[model samples]
Target: MAEHAEAEHEEEAEPRPKRAPIDWRRGREQAFSILASIVRWVGLIFAALLVLHVIFVIGSANSANGIVSFVRGWADGLSLGFKDLFTPSDAKLRVLVNYGIAAIFWLIVSGILARIIRRIGGVVSS
Candidate 1:
């Protein structure tokens, strides 16, 4: 019993492992990653709005409809002045081409911006 008690005392005397310190750089990187993700999501949303507007126009959706008008309004604003970039004989084709270009532009620009932000964050953390 005494030996067992002495063994228990020895076990209790051992030091516990120390935890690693919190890294603020890791937090900064995580913040940058979240920002990049948000940027990508915004780009996707803009592209989706443009595509939805194209669908509405092509399908002859009623412009008077609130949802259709809302989408059209947002798409027009997000078009980045590409609405009249292309002139086609058919109105539907014109909208398709111009809006498609705008959507692609947004996607590409956002991707580039996100990459830049990530690189900046990496450099700052380092």
Candidate 2:
């Protein structure tokens, strides 16, 4: 009887499973991915707006149209300092100089920002 009781007690004391180690490098990578995606989305939005502005300028989109008005307003706000970087006498060249330059500028700036964000995330996760 004493042997049986000891055997039952030993059986009940099952060993616990070991926990999997956390992969912090993977976590950092995930963080960087999410940040990059957000930055890319923002960059795309700005690019689209600039493109629209270029169309509006080139096509002479009617300001009376709500969509045209809205796009122009947004582009005006976004271009800000970039609006008159080059005052080309020709209308087509002026549009390209203003909206095209702003678009390029936004793309470069957003890429730099994404890099910075990824580095910060990596440092924090590590």
Candidate 3:
């Protein structure tokens, strides 16, 4: 009876299964996800900067101020030539429309690029 019990205990002590090797395809998918997130965040930041600049202009913030100047410089560069796309008689309205359109453009372009990247990653995984 004792020998039978010992044999049963030994049988129950089987080794755990070995872990599988890391999958490079999964790593590629993760890399693509990270890239997409970065693109999305960059676009969001650009849009935010443009909107902030618009707010500063409409609120008549001092152009000579350091913060205003910095934001203005960045916003101008990110405007993609849309800064002066319209020539409304009212300066405020012009900024509103042009910068607004530029902001929307960034958002849309980023979203599309992110989606495409994710799709490519999915295809590679499959």
- Candidate 3 yields a Cα-based lDDT of 0.93
Each candidate's lDDT (Cα)? 0.95, 0.86, 0.93
Over the full model, what C-alpha lDDT does candidate 1 score relative to the true structure?
0.95
- Select the stronger candidate by lDDT from 2 and 3: 3
Tell me the RMSD of model 2 versus the true structure.
3.7
lDDT of 2 by residue, 1-126 (tens): 999999999988988789999998888889787988799789879878988989887888787999998888888888868888899899878877888889888898888888888888878777
Per-residue error at 46 for model 1, in Å?
0.4
| Candidate 1 C-alpha lDDT tens digits along 28-96 | 999898898899889999999999999999999999999999999999999988999999999999999
TM-scores for all predictions: 0.83, 0.75, 0.83
The C-alpha RMSD in Å for every predicted model, in order, reads 4.7, 3.7, 5.4
Model 3 C-alpha lDDT per residue in residues 1-126, reported as the tens digit of each score: 999999999988988799999999999999999998899999999999999999999999999999999989999999998988999999999999999899999999999999998889889888
Residue 121, candidate 3: how far off, in angstroms? Answer: 0.9
Best by lDDT: 1
What is candidate 2's CA lDDT for residue 21? 98
Q: Give candidate 2 regions above 4 Å deviation.
A: 1-21, 123-126
Question: Worst 10-residue stretch by lDDT in candidate 3?
Answer: 117-126
